[model samples]
Target: MEVHTVSETPPDRPPQSGLVRALKVPRNAVIGIGFGIALAVVAYLARVLELLGPFAGTREYPVLGPEGWFLVLAFVLATSTALLVASVLTVVEIVRLARTVDE
Candidate 1:
């Protein structure tokens, strides 16, 4: 013979543990990583095409030669892009968390 208001209602699910919360990643970060991987694949394909072209092995880069230099550059590009995207999304998530906490 009791009635409960919304404020007194029990939660549907139990609270998450600290470790579980910490391990969770925001959706934006996952999307950013996916985009980064796609970009890396494109970069690798481009390198392969360039190396297979008519000028293959004809020219040399400064330190590592054409093949090595291209590989390094592609790696740099992929890493930087992924880091940049993940950082931006992380910042956005932090801001969102702050707003919710303030409420």
Candidate 2:
């Protein structure tokens, strides 16, 4: 029979906290992806209702511009930006935690 004793010393690099660990979710981006989805729906309905039809000539209200294409793009970009920023922050936080542990 062999008896092995593990060392009590702390790890060189500690594991990150649960909050920091949660940021690893790809789809869990902190951005407004859901909000973007809703905006897309609204833009679709606006186009269908021809709400922007009147602006076709005057090119008024960016929302009504180019058949509301701009609005769709804006909403999607906005959501992506938000999510991107959130994900970045999460990554930074995790990195910071890792740095602390390494120290």
Every model: Cα RMSD to truth: 11.6, 10.2
lDDT of 2 by residue, 1-103 (tens): 9999999998687566655456554444534465556666676666657676743555455546564666667577667765766677667767877898899
Looking at model 1, the pairs that clash are: none
| Candidate 1 C-alpha lDDT tens digits along 33-81 | 7777789778767776764455535665787777677677777877778
Worst 10 contiguous positions by lDDT, candidate 2: 23-32
lDDT of 1: 0.70
Query: Residue 74: error of model 1 in Å?
Result: 0.7
Query: What root-mean-square deviation over C-alphas does model 2 reach?
Result: 10.2
Report lDDT (CA) for all predictions. Answer: 0.70, 0.63
TM-score of each: 0.54, 0.40
Off by over 4 Å in 2: 1-17, 20-67
State model 2's lDDT.
0.63
User: Deviation in angstroms for 10 in model 2?
Assistant: 29
After aligning candidate 2 to the native by TM-score, how far in Å is the CA of 66 from where it should be?
A: 1.6
Best by lDDT: 1
